[model samples]
Target: MRHRRPEDRRPPWGVRRTVFSGLVPLVVLFGWFTLAIRLGLPSAEPVGFLPFVFVAFAALVGFGRWLARAGILLALLGLLPVLAVLLGGWTATGDEILLSRGKPVVVLVSAESAHRLKAGLAYTYDVRNPDGSTDSLEPGVGTRLPVGSQVTVVEDPDRLVAPQLAGRQDPAVPLVFACLGTASLVAVVVSTAVAGERRRVRNATTR
Candidate 1:
């Protein structure tokens, strides 16, 4: 019965390890963003499918065994904006109700305006459109919203995910961002460390 030497056991597969490393972060991110959507993120614009593309890129590149860990870091760094944009979508979606309705949100205008919305609420900071045009103010929450003037419109009591305009705005967005960000960072760090350790082991065996 002959025992096989470590190197004789065949070089450890690289692509599989890298692919697995990339996938771990993606699954976590998907879960987070999905949950965010479920919680009803507000936005005036429709959410798009760009997040999946970047995540896929990260996963596929992780399988590039020829690349150094630093290269992997850069690849992952490039994906950050995609992730942020996706999360920004969630933020916008969750807040869209107010914006669409032109809800009055209290924003501090010049030093003289002493108006303040109730704490923990969402409001619109209506400003003149960039084209330097003005529209007649209507009788909605944001009606007569002046330049730099802030006002808080009453929150719709009916919707479950309606953003609170009076007490506690969307608090979940920051948490979701932190969770996803931390997970991505950890994935990169762990993958790099593992790659380094593997190189060390290989070197010892070859000596």
Candidate 2:
């Protein structure tokens, strides 16, 4: 059998750095999700398949220059969700507005006073409209509007049945966040492994 050359014997440094970098995001996301659950938010079950993917990618890219490139790509991809959350870009799209006769300003009577609907709630009439007409809505209409609050009716304001707070719950937002997280984790693992292997080789050469 032909002898293995020393140059081809070891892995690259970039892989080591990628592995470490990947772990940083993983820890952060795990801590965040744990805190969210403690804070009474509904947290989705953890994805079980991610660790295997990370291991596989790291093994495949180990000692390869491609690990360095992948590390950069993943780090950049991870930023997408972060920016979306920060800039209020996580709001849902394709929202439909409906028409309803509304008073410019109405006093919130109470949560109990709001008419409960199948998916949302409606505000009850305790005040008159600008046209001085008695405003009445179906029991479930306008239910999404918060009680004890005042809203401006620029146009007929049809609200969501399960109205989330403004600028919350974008489908794209969570998906991007998850993607960023997964990619970053993989990059970290691969890069870290490569870097460690390179360090070993360098140390061996010096000795």
Candidate 3:
């Protein structure tokens, strides 16, 4: 078996340090903005702001190579909120401009299509609107509701994002994501604990 390297057994640097000045604020701003959108707050256009956040993530990762694991973890955790919002876990504020689906009208799904490749599949469909409108919807990840099936579609007059399938998502997608997130969190916690214990043992031996 391979032995641990001296560097691997050492503790990570503290979060408070002169070397991390430029990195901290960028992380806070992007994390706060993404979390705000995730919490069901209204934004005039939320998706449009992601490019800047992506740039910030890239810059932070490049500048903080010494803390690569921690930087990467922070960025990935920051994205959990955005993923939840996209997955329909939190889409409305109960006051989004008329709440077209408050009482939630259900209509026959007019058309449907799905495309598949090695990466994954994207599903979309059109549905008859509550007020006699035809809204095309690209809904959250799930089993695609078939054409001629009945589904509720939620839209806003303010048009913050795509019209969402009111309640047509398959239960499997969210369950899978929840499992993955929990596993990742557990792995992170266990690894940190092991590392801390190793550091303590190394210090005790030195004494």
Candidate 4:
């Protein structure tokens, strides 16, 4: 009937350790992504970030035994944002295809504004078309232009999509999201496999 020491009673994987294990990989991934974008690297697609994802998963598997279940859950949750971004990109692509058949128009930027997004700053311009019609155009994230600047854009004849900047259809933003989503799926699969193998080994040892 000896009393157990407090340290001995504590679980091997404490709350702080679990949190650190989970957050370290995420922080590292965020830093790498930001650096890639700043350096103008080819990070617009899922393939570009595959190496980083592999490293992240490796770290989790090697160092975070308790994190496998959490990783699977987080990975599943991550798919929501990926789906939303892909849906938006699909709609935009369809609009662009429709606008391509229409004539190009030169629009004057009447006003300019900047907004802060999660990734970075995005610019919006109030553009005046030749027909005296005005519309707001987003040139994309990290783009900036002075007011009164003239830009060429393809206008949709059926108004299916808003006027889009000509020669500026960069899929970087959407593809980045796709990369993250793919990484999450990979994490789920790897974590599940690791967990199952570990459980099988423990069962064999106990028997």
Candidate 5:
């Protein structure tokens, strides 16, 4: 038998390489999902998905055979959220959860406009805060409200997402969290589209 170098220990597709790098990470991924949901984690899908992506990315980039396999497992298991969201009858509603409760505040809209998005227009505004401070606020709705208008704005205490016009606050805000897991699915789809577009352009240039 011939002596091999340190790097030769993982022969890319050997039994040891597959077990340590592959099997262990899958176990970790399953644990993340099971424990995250059972313990009530925030954005449970994303919280679990990211670790696997990171580990697998690191492994593939040469952290060693076992670590790489683990990373691969994490990456593979991360797809659970994506599949569930896409196939499950989930729809993107007009409204999203802004805050647990709406705070009633008077805002003087010094400026407002409708900026066009890929699909529709979003209403953005410059409003005067309660303390007489200036700030930029967007109502995330479609409608024309001229400058110098006084309107009610509801800001969440946690400030998790953008504040909305007080009129837009839903009574169910405190009790609901829907559009379930659309974030990761949307991000993945957008990223894939961008990457594919770039690849197409690159291929076209070579011809």
Candidate 6:
């Protein structure tokens, strides 16, 4: 039996390496997503898909055996929220742009009902359109107004997107989702790389 070198015997998933691998990707992703939001980019799907691609590449290159499997699982689970963030961002951005070009009509919409979802509380509203037509609208999450309370909202003339509450276009929701999704992907990459490095070192020592 060949004796393993000191370097090879050291823990591959050391605190420093784990933290470095996790944080670097997270910081980079945060910056990228923030920039995309500022620039009014329709979606961040390309960057969001990077973790999956990286996992596939790692598998091809014979990295960590467990990495490929775990990475794929993590990436898939993370992808849902990432896709949601992008889609919601795209819709919100489009609504803002459209409303900017045209005059937004302010209307008083009464809360029809409120219900709790697994994600959060959601509100349904009874809206009277400028065209004198009545419609029921369920604006996805984040309203605290009591039922029957008349809330002011800017009606989209084209109805391409859901009516947004007046003076309430917040980017915080998307940012939160972006962070969560990115962190999941980062964990996969970092763990996989560390495992692969340890395997390589062990193989070299045994030879």
Q: Write out the backbone clash pairs for model 4.
A: none
Q: Work out the TM-score per prediction.
A: 0.32, 0.30, 0.42, 0.44, 0.40, 0.43
Q: Residue-wise lDDT of candidate 4 within 77-164, one digit each (tens)?
A: 5445334334334434434454457568899999987778777998778889898988777776777878988988766665545566
Report how far off residue 74 is in candidate 2 (Å): 13
* Candidate 5 residue lDDT tens string, 1-207: 988989887555334433443444334444543443333222211234455445434533332223322324433433544334322211111123433454667888897666676547876678787788765665654666679988887664544334556666453432222223334433433333344345545677999
Whole-model lDDT per candidate:
0.46, 0.39, 0.50, 0.57, 0.46, 0.52
lDDT of 2 by residue, 1-207 (tens): 999899877765545455665555456544543343233211111122235334433433432333333444443443443333222211112112211232234433233344454656554433234445433322234545444455443223432222222233345655455556545545545454456556656778999
Reference-based lDDT, residue 110, model 2: 36
Candidates sorted on TM-score, descending:
4, 6, 3, 5, 1, 2
In candidate 1, what residue range of length 10 has the lowest lDDT sum?
134-143
lDDT of 6 by residue, 38-117 (tens): 44332212244445344434432332234333445545544554455444455456455545743456454654676776
lDDT of each residue in 1-207, candidate 3, tens digit only = 999999877655532232244335445544644564454333322344466457645543443333333456545654553344333322333233324433455767888877663546767677786668776666644557878888766556555444655554344555455445435433433344344445545677999
lDDT of 5: 0.46
The weakest ten consecutive residues by lDDT in model 2 span 89-98
Residue 1, candidate 6: Cα error in Å is 37
Evaluated against the true structure, the overall lDDT of model 3 is 0.50
User: Which regions of candidate 2 fall more than 4 Å away from where they truly are?
Assistant: 1-163, 166-168
Off by over 4 Å in 4: 1-88, 91-99, 170-207
lDDT of 1 at 178: 44
Report the lDDT of model 4 for residue 15.
44
